[model samples]
Target chain A: MNAMTMIELGIAIIILIGTIVGFLSAIGFLRLPDVYNRAHALSKSATLGVLCVLVGTFLVFLFVEGYFSIKLFLGIFFVFLTSPVSSHVICRAAYRSHVSLAEISVRDDLKEAIIENNKETEDM
Target chain B: MAIQVLANLLIGLLWVFFQDDWSVLTFFSGYLFGLLVIFILRRFLPTKFYLFNLHAMIKLLFLFIVEIVVSSFVVIGIIIRPKMNIKPGIFSMETTLKGDIEVTLLALLITLTPGSVVVEISQDNKIFYIHTMDIPDLSNSVLQSKDRFENAIKKVTR
Candidate 1:
């Protein structure tokens, strides 16, 4: 009914949604078939989950605490920028290390490219 | 760059005056606010360098948000279901965009999108090796990724 209560309600909803998303990401990690799929689950769901939580925290600080912190904004930005890069690096390393794809995978386009590169190097 | 820094300083001072707070946090917030203002007016400014188009950036951001939410649900569905019949595969996509920044941005976008992760980039940077969780039709998947993610990034960076 009051402004403070309303703000509290909004923050609770946001945090609840974020918690659900984080739970789903963990489920995805357990249920997905392969490393690539697991990575997808971790990167997309986990990143969004954290972002939601951070945004909710930002709102809380801005509305309830009556002060803004640049640290929160920077935390959100750094997570947004770095998560994808780290995921990409992990996937790339996995691929290069020849981690087998899922059994149902239909294609291996990178295999052909790598083979072609090997042939070119051999020719040289 | 010097002018931009001076303008940001002025904005920061103004923010301190209005907020009645002289903390480092408020100063950085004001500087960020100034950068945002300049970003919005980038196109109209007389600068030699190609300023990022705010509209394109915002559009890309919106697209990213939508994609993230949609894909998160999709992945969650795949996970929660009793039967998981994912046909994952690595596909090579040829891109028109050049430069490390543009290509890297595209790869990052693809990796962030649900059901896909970029595994490799060719030596020439023309092709991206992406691993997708579902690839019922490889060509269609490649085309869809090109249209959905790559094109949006191209609009922003190119």
Candidate 2:
């Protein structure tokens, strides 16, 4: 009936959902055949999972301290900005370091790009 | 005048409703402060509201909330379970998120979630390196991540 109850429900919902997804990502991380694949599960799912918690917090703050909601909004904005870039950097580093892939991977775009660069250098 | 009052009223209602230490006078004061801040800032900085995309952003927010709740449970489960049950490794992933802001947001999100740590990023900003506490097949998981996570972010931000 009260707003606190609603906020608590929202928070509980978010926590439950986050725990499930995080568990899945962790499972994927452990079970996957190679480092590259494990990276995928960890980065993507986890990023999404945390965002939800932050949002729940944001909503709670919005209801509790409406004036301070803007700050939470900014925090969400920062999360939106940083997660992908770090993931990109990490993935690229793994690629450059020659992390092996599973038998299932067929195409290697970065390798192809490297080959092309070498051939061009030879031609020159 | 009407719009201002409405905005103030809605914001005030939210504040009064959520506060643990409820005080009507304090709530009004806070609301007035917010309004004043917005008024002064608007003059110096013009903001693009992204009004058309607001609805889409809201939808993404909901989806993100779901992900967080699910993942938090995942972390808790890991803690409760034995370390021997864990499978740890690193993986690389491709992404279509072009903007720096978007990529960074994604990385921070990954870090915040349990069992996943974003280790590095590529110079081109197209790939992400991640460490996960558990995975069965790295390549498959990576692909799934791209589909599930990277794509979702692209839809929301772009």
RMSD to the true structure for each prediction, in A, is: 4.7, 10.1
TM agreement with the true structure for every prediction:
0.82, 0.47
- DockQ each candidate and list the results: 0.73, 0.10
Question: lDDT for every model?
Answer: 0.81, 0.61
Q: After superposing candidate 2 on the true structure, give the runs of residues whose Cα lies further than 4 Å from its correct spot.
A: A1-3, A65-67, B1-158
Q: What is the lDDT of residue B79 in candidate 2?
A: 45
Clashing pairs in 1: none
Model 1: per-residue lDDT, tens digit, B1-158? 34655776898889888999988888889878877887777777665223345577788888767877776777777777888877888888888888887788777777766678888899999988888888864346446766667677777665
Q: iRMS for all predictions?
A: 1.1, 7.9
Model 1 complex DockQ against the native: 0.73
| Best candidate (score: DockQ) | 1
Model 2 residue A46 distance off true place after TM-score fit, in angstroms: 0.2
